[model samples]
Structure formats: C-alpha cells, structure tokens
Target: MYLADGLVPYTEVFSVLDWWKVAGTRYPTLRKVARDIFAIPVTTVASESAFSTSGRILSEHRSRLTPDMVEVLMCSQDWLRNKCKGEQIM
Candidate 1:
C-alpha cells in the first residue's frame, strides 16, 4: 500500500472503503483512485510528530524502564504534545 509509482489496484482492496461517496467523477484517474489508491491525507502529521517526540523521551539512558514507568512516560509524552485529555500546547 506504500510504494513507488503510487499504485494500489482496487480489485484486491475493498474491505474499508465507501466508494458510493465519490463513485461518479468526470476524470477516470480520480474515479480509479477514489477507493483504490488510498492515502493518508492529514495536512499535519501530528501522529508521526508525537511518536518522534515519544522516542526522544524514552531513548538510551532511560532504556531500563519498567512497564509502569514506560506507560507513565508515554502519557507524559501525549500530554506534552497536547494530545491527551486536558492537554494544552505550551
């Protein structure tokens, strides 16, 4: 689903699609890609950014962390990124 030329034929991918929403388009290319070549269209890659921040928080020196400590750090990361409940951008 993630490769060059950006080709993902619809014949094998249909479990998670709603083609009825845009099934009728004037352009063949648009119609073909409407449900076929699915792409992540989030303008801002906040999720990726969050993960990168998390990695920076849990690197080498803090490698020997317990499960609970890891979870707490993950929560802290989400809060820092303003992605958790009651989160704020500071």
Candidate 2:
C-alpha cells in the first residue's frame, strides 16, 4: 500500500518524473497507467508533410505530368530536402 505525503498535490506537479516522485508513492497503479498512456506516440505530421509536398508537385496544372516524371520530381525533391548524397533514385 502507498500513502500520500500530502506535501504536494499530484495536479501541481507538471513533469512526469516529478509526478511519479510525488503522486506515484500514493497511486502506483495510476502512475503506471499514466506512464503507459504517455509512452504511446502521438499522431505525426511527417508523412503529411511528404504528402503535402507531393500534392504541390503534382498540382492541377501539373496533373498532365507522367507518373515517371512525378516520381523523378518527388525523388529529387526528397533528396534535395534531405541533403542526401547517393546514386539517383531509380
């Protein structure tokens, strides 16, 4: 069994580590739940960024561009954006 120190409220502690150190002693299960939930990764915009760039590259007027050209343009864009140094993307 854990006992609350009552010295500090759990809500007052802003940091995960700080909360664990303070409220964890009083609510170990709740702490574990919070840890697990916090460990889960949030939605990422990285893939969306890539898609957005692709959309810009293949916009309405450029829709006539062939798939091969689109692929090449996208590859070049990615390579330049990432500063990649290697053989061209096939």
Candidate 3:
C-alpha cells in the first residue's frame, strides 16, 4: 500500500511523523519502528570533529601511548561522561 501511494507534493509542508500518525492504523508495525527511529535526537556536529579526540587526548607527554590504549581511553571517557549525565538526571 505504501509503495502505491503517491509522493507528497513539493508545495505541501508534509512531515514524516505526521504521515506516520495518520497511517498508524494501516501500518502499525512500521509506525512503531519509525517512532523509535525518529525519536533519536539529531546532531549537526561534523563526523570528523565529533570523533576526533586527538588534540585533547594526545599531547607531547602522551605521544608514547599506543593506538589501542588511546581508543580505550576515548571509549572510557565517553562512557563516564554519559553515566554522569544519567546520574544527574535521576
């Protein structure tokens, strides 16, 4: 049924969420999945900047650290930061 549906007109201000809401009855399973997927917050940060921790984590004194160790440190930092935020919210 979705495949046969016509595309939304360019002039119309159509929202994916709005369409899902109206079509929820027709596509209950898909509507649930779409809701969960769309619930994730959007990020505007560039991938390069978001993943690069080299400047902050790497310095002259820390240059000796292996790549594997650097990766572990980066993962630990992110986990701790997220854990702290979760604690504060509760």
Candidate 4:
C-alpha cells in the first residue's frame, strides 16, 4: 500500500533497480543508468512558461539596473502570469 499510494512518478522511477540508486548513495549495487532520462534537456526552464517576463525584468545590455525596478517588474510578472490568463501574449 505504501508504494502504491505514497509515491507517483518517483515510484515509477524506483521500480527500476537502476534508478533506485538515487535513493541511497551507500548502495553500490546500482549505478546512474538513466543518464539522459530527462525528457527535456533542462528542468528549471521547462518548469516555467516563458522568459518574456524575465526580459522586461532584466537587461543584458547594462549592469546598472536598479533593485527597485527589478522588484516592480517581478511583481508585475507574477500578477500578469497568474491573473491575466485570457489576454493576448504579445
């Protein structure tokens, strides 16, 4: 019951003896067989929607951006992303 109800994707992963290696570092029986297991190349960006919000918040051209502007941009981003769902993304 524990295995069935306690876990979802991790359980699916652990079913394989190879992936079970992630659970315990001491267990030398299993190695990292799932090297390129990630469906996406990167996990952090995949978890997010778009970098447009980031772009308005940060500038690569200049390093003198103020912290207050960054904060306001972040707040606007969170609000728009969460509340303005039906609006056209342009």
Candidate 5:
C-alpha cells in the first residue's frame, strides 16, 4: 500500500542519495525504480559542454594531432572537467 496519497516536494535537502536513503524504507518498490532513475546521467549538458571543449582542442593549430591522440585529449578533458565538478552553462 502507498504510504502517502501523493509525493510532496522535499525542502531543506542536501544530496540525492540522502533523500533516497531516508525515503527508500517507506517505499521499497518505488525505491528500486527511483534509484535507477537517479542513476541516469539525466542531461546532455555534459556532453554538449565536452563537445565545446573538443572544438577548442581540434582548432587549426592543433589539427596535426592524430585521431587516437584527439580521442585521448577529448576523453581526458571530459574526465578532468567532471572530476573538478566544474560548472557548465546550459
């Protein structure tokens, strides 16, 4: 049986995991799907931002870089950007 008739917006929160940790117990079946939903990338903003960086990396001056090298550079840039949690404009 559903615990609440409807879900209310939670306020005063920190992380997504924190919300799931508390609410999961109240709704096991829902929680299973909710965790997967939360696991998804959820947006293309990161990829778009990465493409912007890739453009910069492949400019005329650096065009001599080989295909494999280009791939490495692009992947490295994406990894570093994510590691730093840099902000990307939508």
Candidate 6:
C-alpha cells in the first residue's frame, strides 16, 4: 500500500523525517522501524578518521582484543566525546 501511494510533493515537506512523522500513523509497523532507524544521530566525521582510529586501536600490541571489545571501545569513545562537547556548550 505504501509503495502504491503517490510521491509526496517536495514543497509540502521539509525532509524525509517530517514526511514520516506525518504519514507514520497510517503504517504503524513501518513507522516504528523508520523511527528507530532515523533516531540515530548523523555523524559529520571524515571516513579517514575512522580508518586511522581503527588502525591505532588495533595496533600489534592490541591485536588480541576481541571484536566485541573493539565495538565497546569505539562506542565509549564516541559517547565520551559527545558528553564532553555537551559540557563545553554550557
């Protein structure tokens, strides 16, 4: 049913998020998934930074760290950075 619907005019909506917010009630399941997917904050960091960070984190001395540990470290680093920025803003 969703795919059959006509495309929304760009003039009527500011963004995909806005469109979802308005039309979501008609498709409850899809809306839930879309909400979860869109809730993630977008990052502006360059791709090079990710490569360099991973390289440093997985250096020979740290190569034995499990994939789960690597994920935890990356998420923790990002959370800490965001927290510090929020503190600085005040």
Query: What's the lDDT for all of these models?
Result: 0.59, 0.71, 0.77, 0.54, 0.74, 0.76
Q: Roughly what TM-score does model 5 have, to 2 decimal places?
A: 0.34
Better of 1 and 4 by lDDT: 1
Stretches > 4 Å off in candidate 2: 1-16, 50-90
- Cα lDDT for residue 43, model 6? 93
lDDT for 69 in candidate 5 is 95
* Model 5 weakest lDDT span, ten residues long: 47-56
TM-score of each: 0.26, 0.35, 0.41, 0.29, 0.34, 0.42
lDDT of 1 by residue, 13-70 (tens): 6743354443334345665665465554655667667566434556677778887987
Ranking by lDDT: 3, 6, 5, 2, 1, 4
Runs off by more than 4 Å, candidate 5: 3-17, 45-90
Error of 1 at 21 (Å): 78
Give the clashing residue pairs of candidate 5, or none.
Answer: none
Better of 3 and 4 by TM-score: 3
Candidate 3 lDDT by residue in tens digits, 1-90: 766878766756778767777888887887888789888999998976765675677779889999999989888767767786785423
Q: Candidate 3 vs candidate 5: which has greater lDDT?
A: 3
Across 1-90, the per-residue lDDT of candidate 5 in tens digits comes to 566557657787668677668778977999988778778875657765745663467778888999999889777777767777975534
Top-scoring candidate (TM-score): 6
Q: Please list the Cα RMSD from the true structure of every candidate, rounded to 1 decimal place.
A: 13.1, 12.4, 14.8, 11.6, 12.6, 14.0
Q: What shift in Å separates residue 74 of candidate 4 from its native position after superposition?
A: 1.1
Arranged by TM-score with the best first, the candidates are: 6, 3, 2, 5, 4, 1
Model 6 sits at a Cα RMSD from the real structure of 14.0
lDDT of 4 by residue, 1-90 (tens): 223534436443445555455543634332333433533366565436554654455567545768887677677776777676876555
